[model samples]
Target: MLYVFLSICCSVIVSVLLKLAKRYQIDVFQAITWNYSMAILLTWFFFKPTIPSLQNAPIHIYLGLGVLLPLLFMVMATSVRVAGIVRTDVAQRLSLFIPLLASFLIFGDSLNKLKVIGLIIGFAAILCSIPWQKKTANRKVYSNAWIFLLIVFFGIGIIDILFKQVALFKEVPYTTSLFLIYILAFVIALIVLIFRVATKKTKFSWPHIMFGWILGVANFGNILFYLKAHTSLSKSPSTVFSAMNIGVIALGTLVGLVVFNERLSILNKVGVALAVIAIVVITIS
Candidate 1:
């Protein structure tokens, strides 16, 4: 439980940092590049992963995670920029519902009445939380917001499911998996960076680089604790995922109100209430 709570807190801090990045004039791409680089270094220093023999592990695991990691970071950063932190977090976290449904259908995971109810309520809560306003002007800004949220949903949902699959390798130390995953992600990002440089579009900024490091550290901490908690708890990973999400939403909302001075419309208020109810149903289920 302590690990779970700490992980959620780390998530909130990540959101807060991203929100602050706008004010600090941090470029999203550069920030993420540096973030991953720093995370790789930090993980190396602390975890000291033992190299896994390729002969033993499935080759696809490495290949798939290599592709997924960079895309996940890019989409998540874009989602934060398009939607506010609160909405981005909600969209990404709510994706667990998709995986829960998938698990039941594909893996024959059982869903009791309470679990089903909780899933339904949680889904409804996410829908309610989406701010749908009739456009008063010609601005199409919010259009991208919806698309970004969808991307976040799909990316995070797939990632969560993938993590569960990876977790099945009980012999693979968590630290080793973490190191290999991030190392692959960094190498991929570096390759892309080289391409960007070759195209003469590589402009580096210190702010982006520094913030990226901060983001990397925070993200590493978040995943480390969450993974540990998932390992320790008897609850299903999906359930733990859902509970941690509720914590992020609650914390994000409080920070949004206090720090960003973001106000909720009546609809938003109702949406929040529904979200809370959904969380309750999911929790006690």
Candidate 2:
């Protein structure tokens, strides 16, 4: 239970940190690049994943995630900044529906009644959670925020499915596979950073390194504590899953409303309520 609590805190804190990045003048791209460097170090120290032979490793999935993780991370940062934490977090949690949809449509799983209902509610939740506002002078700018939210919803969903593939590959320890994926992601991020710096798009900033390490710590802590929660409650995998999704949504809402002073419409609140209900229904079904 403590692990679950810590994991939830860490998850929400990541959003809060990203939310503060702009205020602190942190370079998000450089910070993200350094974030992977810190994550690699933490993955080694904590998980100590043994480097297995790469001959049978799932390199393709790793490469895909390597590309998507950093890219979507930037998208998520943008979403947090524009759409606010409440809507962004809800969208991320509800992304579970993507893999659930894949299971039914692509993997030939049965479309049971409960799952059908859950999916319907989940779809509604997404629509309601969108940060729809009245048409103002900057209506076009505000409307574009939803596009970032949509990208995060789909991007994270695809990343989740790829991670499921990594989990299915038993030839290597999951932690070891994670380490290699982090290395690949770091390399790609570094390449892009180098290019941007060379082209004078963005100069190097030391502040990004410090902020990135902090972000990495929170990011890695979220994973670590979540895994510990699962291990601690080995008999209740569903409990861990449900708690993680619901907890992040709930806590993130609190932070966004109280700490960040983010406003949501009545419909947005209803969507958040439905998102929680959908998680419970999906978990039980």
Candidate 3:
């Protein structure tokens, strides 16, 4: 449970850093690129993951997820910028359902009646936590944005499944898998950053680099502890799934409320409340 809570906290801190990036005039892409570099270096320093063992493991999963992480991140960025933050966030959070379902169907994880109820409530809580407002002005509809949102939703769920699959590998160290993916993602993000700068689309900034380091530490912690939680709760991936998602949404909501003074609508309040309930129920089970 310590691992679970620490992982959740790290996830929320990552979100907060990203949210604050705009206010500080930080280049988020650059920060993310540097973040990958920092994560890779830090992961090596602390975990010292054995690399050669990966040669015997499934290389495709590592490469597939390496490419998918940034692709999905870009999809999520487009979804948020075009659709609106609330919808994008809810869709992203609700993505746990994909892996949660896969847990039973693919991994043979089980759920009892209480667990099922908790999951249903957790889903509802995610929906409610995100506020929806009717557009006051009639604007052009871009169905493409909706498509991108679906891509992000399912795409992240697929990532979750991949991570779980990696955890199942008895031979490959989870940190080694993460280290490889981080290197791949860094290469991709570096290329993007360089191209964007060369095209005069973005300027290099020091603040972004600094924030990226901070983000890297937190992001690495998030993945490390999350993977550890899976190893800790090996028999109940579903519990960790539901708990992690709901806990992030619910606790992230509290941070936004108390720390940032963000206002939540009545529905959002109800959703946060239910999120708490879902976490409690799932934990007890």
Clashes of each: 1, 0, 0
lDDT of 1 by residue, 1-285 (tens): 678778888888888987788787777666766777887788889978888776776457756776787877777777766666557766776687776766666545566788678667666655655555533244334666888898888878777666666655676787787777777887888787668768987776676788899899898888788778667753456566666766676666767878899876676566567657766775666
Predict model 3's lDDT versus the native.
0.85
Output the number of the lDDT-best candidate. Answer: 3
Model 1, runs deviating above 4 Å: 75-94, 106-108, 134-138, 141-152, 273-285
Q: For residue 103, give model 3's deviation from the true position in Å.
A: 0.5
Q: Total backbone clashes of model 1? A: 1
RMSD of 3: 1.7
Ranking by TM-score: 3, 1, 2
Instruction: Provide the overall lDDT of each model, using Cα atoms, as 2-decimal numbers.
Output: 0.72, 0.75, 0.85
Shift in Å, residue 144, candidate 3: 1.6
Order by lDDT, highest first: 3, 2, 1
Spell out the clash pairs found in candidate 2. Answer: none
Stronger candidate by lDDT (1 vs 2)? 2
User: Which clashing pairs does model 1 show?
Assistant: 35-212
